[model samples]
Structure formats: structure tokens, C-alpha cells
Target chain A: MLRAAVEAGADAVYCGFQNATNARNFAGLNFTPKELQDGVAYAHTRGTKVLLALNSFASEGRFELWKHAAECGADCGVDAFIVADIGVASHLANQLPQQRLHLSVQAAASNPEAINFYCREFGIARAVLPRLLTITEIRNLKNEVDCEIETFVFGNHGLMVEGRCSLTNYAVGVSTNMDGACSPASHVRYERDATGGMTANLGDHVIDCFAPCDQAGYPTICKGRYRTPVREEPYYAFEEPVSINLMDMLPELIGAGVDAFKIEGRQRSRTYAGQVVGAFRKAIDAILAGQSPNPIDLIGLTEGHKQTQGAFLTKKWR
Target chain B: MSITPLAKLTLGPILFHWDAAAKCDFYARIADECPIDTVYIGEVVCSKRTPFFERHLPEVIERLERGGKTVVLSTLAEVVLPRERKMTTELCAQSDYLVEVNNGAGLGPIAGRPHRIGPTLNVYNVQSMVHLASRGADHFTLPAEIPGNVAALIGAAARPIGVGIEVQVFGRAPLALSARCFHARAHGRSKDDCRFVCEADPDGLQLSTLSGGPFLAINGIQTLSWGYVNLGAELDAMCAAGICYFRLMPHRTDMVTVAKIFFDRLAGLSSPDEAGACLSALGLGPFENGFWHGRAGHLYHTEPEH
Candidate 1:
């Protein structure tokens, strides 16, 4: 997947170890140290950068796990380390002073003061802004902070505030902040109900039930249907299963002084990564040449085959 | 021979959108009668709701101070708008009262000054706690979903550093916060023109699963558990683990009685069994302690009696 993304015109590729040190701690996913070293060599030879993500919050007795992962990444000669925990960031800054550090979006540093606090405290050179800010808010934040700003342009739309949300932890024992997974597949169960409908359950709680004709998305707590007094039928209380696609607003985001564009596809296939990256690369090149980029169609890669330009167009989304 | 100090009872900031008169009355009762030692006052959820009670703060602060209660101002949990940033900055600039920062934006302004870290801010481990403690954070309210073992680890680490640790021991546990307002969205209105509809539910709007089981509560952008977190059974254990403060989140229910219940429990006047019976009689619906027992937050696990 790293080779496919780099070959498809990605200037940078971020990967993580297959452990709890990173956020995507799923089975049969992520890279080993040997794979990372080989992938870094391949990307660097092709003039691309490889970034290692160590974004989970460190537990009390297990702080050494993150430190070990950081040392492993450094040994593999990665370009930069993306970190979320302050303890890990402080460690990296003190131990590897020459290594560049970028604040992960899991830190939820939405404003200038928060971004500046990371930069001043840990010598962060860049920050990935949380996915909640509008373009105007992003531009305003970019002017006050001292670090480069990155924004998510496409893929998984996590509507909740990152790093602070504990919905998954509430329903199940694991958490996105601590355990690096949300509604982990180990506890998710799907069964056919008596009414010819499919019901998705996380632990013992029913997330939602879909009819025969409906497409059932992943049962993330945020994108689940629930019963309420104000409505008769179960409804999407928080958000619908839709991926965020900022393809149409690329020029606006670039004009807003965004330093980088991130596509969230940590769990996707190589084909998805290649096709999406290739399309984005073409559009970005056209915009750089001062030509109006053609509208790109990548709906096949979205969740539930649905997409929305969330929060970037307006703060009224709240 | 070491003597452990008795835990202090704190009243958390009101997270709902109540009318100004009702807020004043609530604070008045808290001031005149409640046994809580510390009172946190501010709009910690939404910035728009701040103006409704802003005019009454001076009187509220005066009344609480005169009543011998320590008052702290809390910033919003989520800061996104330009005005929200400005609000947090102005909040940190004030020297008249101690501040409790709920978001990362509040850290820089209050870096060198004495402040408290609210439960909304993540302080998962001792390293994170010590990092914030080095920057003038004297007290910290750990996140709601952490188990007792993790809390004990943090509590043990905080002893020699001379900083304080707090945990939410009562009221509905906050689960998640979003950039979009679920309350307004459910009412067919956008956030820009929400018309303050959330004022209708003084406690919070109930959210249930499709099977009619009460699952959660929605307060604008904040999501909370439907079951009240009653740690009555674990108060003694937590105190033994070096926790210094017990926080009670404000609800529309009789919070004065709630504070008295916890106060009596911590004071050793009532056993865990007696306190558990009294708390259950409040009719606050179901109670849960699974988050503390290293299980799901919504599930309850009755502790074995000592």
C-alpha cells in the first residue's frame, strides 16, 4: 500500500507498527520493523518521505511501549514521528533532538493556543488540525500558530472530538484514545432479527438495526441509530455513516494556508489507496498550474457509498 | 505512622442550559446549605449559553465565597470559534478567581499560574499528570472512563509531587463531545439558529437503544451515559488509593441531598451499604460502576463487601 500510494504521486506516506503504540492496532494490519525499513528505503529512493505514527496515549505502567516504538522508528530512519501524548513528545524532543516531530490530530489541538503550546513545549514543527474546524477557522488558526497546519481532505469522518471522546470505552472495554480502536471487531456482533432485519451489536448494546434493503455500515457509536421520544422511529442521533470528501474545496483549503492534505485510509485496500491518491494528485497538479481542476469522482471508496463535505464549508454543521 | 487526609467534596459546574433565575436559585441553595467544599462555576459545554448566566456571576461568586466555599471558573470543553478562543483567553487573563481549564487552548494562558485541569482534558498517566503539574497545574480531575487500577496508579504517582487528584464520583458520566449539536439536529434546526431549545430538558434529553433500553443522554454536542455513576461502594477504596477529591456533576435533581450523601459516606458516618441504600432511594434511575471495575462504562458490577 505504501508503494502504491507513493507510485500514485503521494509525496509522503505515514505507517505504524502493528501494536497498541499506534491508533490502528487491528489484526493483520500495520507494518513490521523490517517492512518499515524496506518501505522507507523504497519511498526515500523515489523522493517521498515516510512518517511513523505513534499516536496513542501512554498508559501508566506501559509508558515504555511507546518509547520502544519511537526508538524502533528512529532506527528505521523515518522522516518524522507523529505523536499525540505529551510524555512521548517530550521524550522524543529530549532524546532525539534532531528528529522532526508533528503533533497528531488525536491531540485535538483545535485552536492557536493549543497548537502553540505543543510547539513551544516540545519543539513541534507541524500539527495536524482536528477535523472540526471550518476553512475560515483554519485560516485564522494558521495565522496565529507557529507550526505548519495539516487538514484531512478525504475519508473517515470522525465527528467526535479526537483524544477526548470515550464513547467506545463506555460501550466496550477498549477505547480509541487508550486501546487505539473504536468499537473493535472483537466485540462486534451482527445477527438477523425476526423481522427480516439485521441488527448490529457492540458488546451487549444494540447499535442499530437495518432493513433488508438498507446497507449496514460499521456500528461505530457515533454513527448509530437510537430511540428517542422526539421521534417515533429509531434515527441517526449523532451522525450518519458518511465519509468526508473535500475534493471540491481543495483550492479553498490550499488558499486557507493549509500546509498538507491528509487522506484517511489506514484500513483500506491497496486499490483504494492507489486510485484515490492518483486522482488527488492530478487535481492538485491542475490547481497548481492555475487551471480550474476537474471534479474527481471517488464515491466508490466512501463509507456506505456516501460522502459529505463536513465542517469545512460551514460551522452551521453543528 | 502516616495519616491520610479526608477526601474533599466538590460540586462540578452545571453542564445543562438552565434559565438565569433558576441558576441563581440553584447556586443560592448550594451556598446557603450544601456541604460541598468547592464549587466550579462557568459554561463548560457551550459558549452561547454563557451569556444567560454571565450577569449573575458576581453575585453568585460573592454568595459562595461568603458561604465559605471555594469557587473556581471553568472554561469551555471544546473551543473552535474565534469568540470561543477569545473567551478562553479572557478567562485565563482574570486574576480574581482560580481557573479550571477544560481544553488545551486554556493551558498556554494559564501555564505559569495556579490552575486546575478539568475531567474533559486527558491526563491518562503519571507522566502526563507530572507534565501538567510542572506547568502550575495544582489539581487534576481524571477522565470519567478510566478504571480504578489506572486511577490508583496515577494517585500513587501524585503523592510525592504534592499535587491533588480528583474523580467524578456522582451524576451522569460524560461519554463524548462532538463538533455538531445532536440536540439541534434532532429538532430539525441548525446550530447557528438553535433558538436555545436545549433549555427544555433541565437534566438532559434521554437517548435509548432501539429495544427501548436507556443507553445515553444528549446535551447539545455533549453525549453522556444515562445511568448515574454511583461510586458509593468504592469511595473508601478510592480514598485508600490516595484520591483526595470527589466530584459531583450538577444535575437538576436535589444535588444538596446528593452532596450530603457523599459527604456522610466519606466522613465514615455511614457504611458503604448504608450509603448505597440512601443513594439508590434518590430515584435517579439506574446506577453504574463498570468503568471503575475495568469493564464497560454502561454496565454495573456490584462490588463484594469487605
Candidate 2:
């Protein structure tokens, strides 16, 4: 899957170590140390680059573990380190000056000053932008900053605060920024209710209950239904389950100074990864070749069978 | 015996919707009774909630100042509109009080001037801390999601620069902020037409999952934990790590008592267990300090007495 991504069109294929140091710290997924070395060799052979994700914040004495992962990544001949913690990024940049550094989306570098600071101090080559910026904002930021920009082209639309979020930890005690998993499956439980509907619970909180006819997505804190005083009726308080598909807006984003397009879901099946990556690879090539890109309907792969351009459209309602 | 405890207590900006008069009265009471050394006053969660208290802010600040408390003005957590930016810039221009930069846009105007970096800025490590300090930040409220070990490292690195460290001690943990208003959406309105719906729930609304279990709370665009975080027991450890301030987020009921409980713990007049018990009695909901202890943030792990 990742090989196809590199072969088809991705400038860098970002994955994480099989540890809690990265945000997608899931079970039976992510690359082991040995697998990471092998993956890097494989990607390099195909003229592709591999970026290691050590994006989660490191605790006090546990800094050595995250630092060790970066050192190990460099030793394995990885292309660059995708980092969130300023401490970890500084450490790796200082320890291995020749190795490239890319700011993780978790860093949430939404402005030029913040991006410039990372570029000036850490020599960051590129920054994966947060999902909150508009196209105009992205264009302005690209002009103001020196580093290349990568934006999410397809995947979960996180309308989140970025970097300061503690929703998952507050529920089940692990956070994407800290422990690398939001609403981890270990703490999540599903059960059948008296109404014969299945209820999804993250820790002690019942996130959602679905009828027999409904399709259930992963149990996450943000994508849950809840009642508030304003409505006095249950509705998605934070956001609905919507996936972002900007395949149609590729030209606009590319024209807006986007250097790369990121496809989310490192935990997805390799088959799904290869399919999406190959499609995007061909799409980008078509755009470059002055041909209309073929329509790629990824509805089956979407989280809720709904798609949005997210903040890019600038529709005040979101 | 030494009289003074190691650190000071800061009252975090009111995150809930209190009627303008009630909001002013709350701060007035804090000035009269609470032993807090600093008080932050501003609308951080929603901009629509700001106008309600705008007229009374001057009086509230004066009363807090009269009570010998160092008052600071805080910026909004998420600033997307041009009008919001203008308001924040005007607030930052006031050199009378310290400005806590909650967003990066707020930080740019106050660069090279002494200010505070709020928890929303994501100060996770020594490098970010140093970077902010170099840009004129003398104090920082570390993100609430950080584990104790990470807090300790930041504390150690910040010591040389004399930058004060503050941590959220009580009230619902603010999980995330967004530009979109969930409250408005719930009421079938856009963010601009919110119509002040948040005013009904002074402490925000409790959100239960489908099975009627406490899940999370929604206050405008901010999502918070169902449990109130009580770090009274961890005060000693945090003090040892060189933390200079402990923040207590305002709630709807018995805030004076809440402040006193924290003050007593800081002053060595009471123990953490006693404070925790007091918190339970007040019905602020279940309390958890797991994140501080480097465990699951929602789980309570009782510590052995030293």
C-alpha cells in the first residue's frame, strides 16, 4: 500500500513507530523497528521517501524513549522525521542535522510566524497544516512562510482545537497528543441495550447507540451524539461523522501553494491504502498533464458515507 | 514553622455563561473571600458571551485589584473573525494588566512585551517554552493534557528564565475548541446568530451518551470532560517541580468554597484527601487526577501517603 503511494504520487509516505509515541498508536498496525527499516529500504528502492511519525508529546523522563525512536529512525535511513514536540524535534534536528524534519499536523502550525519559527530554529523542510485554515489563509501562509506546505486531501475532518485537545484522555485517559490514541479500542466497549440497539461506550461514557439498520463507525469522543441545553434534543454537539474528499478541489489547493496532499488513516487496510494512493497518484498526474482527472468515488471508504470540503469552502456554517 | 506555602493560586477566566450581574458578583465575592493571589477575567470560550459582561468588567477588575489580587485579561481560545481579533487586540493594548495570549494571533501583538502563554498555545517542551520566553512570555499555563513527567521537564527548563508555570487544578477539563459553535448548531442557528443560547447553562450543559451516561459537556465550540479535575493531592509534587501557580476554573456553585479548599491545601491548613472529599460533597461530579499521575486521565489512582 505504502509502496504504491510512493510509486503513484506521494512526496512522502508518513507512518509511525509501533509505540505510544505517535498519534495513530493502534494495535496490530504501525511498523515495528525492523519493519520500519525494511519499509524505508523498500521505499527508497522505488524512489520514494518515508517519514516517521513521532508526533505525540513526551513525558518528563520518558523523553529518552521518543528521542531513541527518532535516533533509530535516522539509523534506519528514513527520509525525515514528522515531529510535534518541539523538544523532540529540536533534539533530532541537533543530533542529525543532515536528516530532514517535517512538522506534524499535530503541531497545528496554522500561522506564518509559528511556521517561520520552526523553519528558522529547527530547519524544518515542510509543515503539515492543521485542518482549520481556509484556502485564502493557506495561500497567505504559503507566501509568508519559507517551508513547503502539505494539507489533508482526504480523511476525517477534524474541526478541533488542535494541540490542546484532551477529549480522549478525559474520557478513557489516552489522548492523541499525549498517548497517541484517541478513544483507544481497549477502553471502548459495545453492548446491546434493552431496545435491541447496540450502544458504543468509551470508558464509562455511552458515545452512541445504533439501531440494527444503522452502520457503526469507530467509537470516538468527538464524533458522538449528545444533548445540550440549547437544543434540549440529542444531536452531534461537536461534529457529525464526515470524511473530507478534496479530489475535486486538487487544482485549487495546488494553485493555493500546497506542496503536497496527505491521505489519512495509517491503520487502514493495505488494500484500501493502495487503492486510494494509486487513485490520487493518477489524479495528480492527470492534473499536471492538463487532462481532466477521472472521477474517483470513495464513498465506500468514507467514515459516514458523507463528504465535505471542510473549511476550504469557507461556508460560514461549517 | 514556616508560614508561607510554596506557590500562588490563580482563578482561571470564567469559561461558563453567567448573567453579567451574576458574573460581576462572582468576581466581587472572590475578591472578598477567596485566598487566590491572581484572577483572570475574560470570555475565553465564546465571543457572544463577552458582551454580557463587558459593561461590568471595569468594576470587577477594580474590586479584584482592591483585594490585592494580580488581575490578568485573557484572549479567546479560537479567533476566526476580524471583529474578534479587534477586540483581543484592544484588550492586549491595555498595559494596566498582564495579557495571557490564549491564541497565536494574540501573541504577535504582544511580542517583546511581558505576557503570559495560555494552555491553548500547546507549550509541550523546553524548546517551545524557550521560544515563547524569548518572545517575551514570563509565565505559561501548561496544557492540561500533559502528564506529570512532561510538566516536570518543562518546569526544570523554565526555572532558569524565571518563567512561572501554572496548571489547571479544578473544574471540567477543556478538551478542545473549534471555530464552529456546537451550541448554535444544536439550536438550529449559525454561529453568528447564536442568540445567546449558552446563557441558560451557567456552567455549560452536561451531555450524556445514548445510554444516559455522563459523557462530555459542551460550551459553545469547546468540548470538556464530564469529570471535574481535582489536583489538590498533586500540589506538593507540582510545587516540587517549580510550578508557581495552580489554576481553578470557575464553576456555577460554591466557587468560594472551591477556592478555599485549594487555598487551604496550598497553605498547608488541609490535606488533598480532605479537599477531595469536600469537592465530592459539593457535587461537582467525579474527580480524576490520572493525567497528572501518567495513567488514564479518567481513572482515579489513589497515591500512598509519603
So what's the TM-score on candidate 1?
Answer: 0.97
Q: What is the interface RMSD of each candidate, in Å?
A: 1.0, 2.5
CAPRI category for model 2: medium
Taking the tens digit of each residue's C-alpha lDDT, what string does model 2 give over A1-318?
577566666666887888878988989778888988888998888788899898888765667779789878988898888887767877887788898999888776766756776787689999998887788888877998889999998888887856667887777767778678877889988888787778788888888778977876667777888765445567877777888888999988888999999998586776677777878888999998989899988888888889888888674654
Over all chains combined, what TM-score does candidate 2 have?
A: 0.91
Query: Cα RMSD to native, each candidate?
Result: 1.8, 2.9
User: How does chain B score by TM in each prediction?
Assistant: 0.97, 0.95
The DockQ-based CAPRI class assigned to model 1 is medium
After superposing candidate 2 on the true structure, give the runs of residues whose Cα lies further than 4 Å from its correct spot. Answer: A194-196, A229-233, B1-3, B48-59, B83-96, B106-112, B153-161, B277-283, B303-306
Candidate 1, pairs of clashing residues: none
Q: What is the lDDT of residue A299 in candidate 2?
A: 80
Model 2 lDDT tens row, B210-256: 66666677788887777888998888888888887899999988999
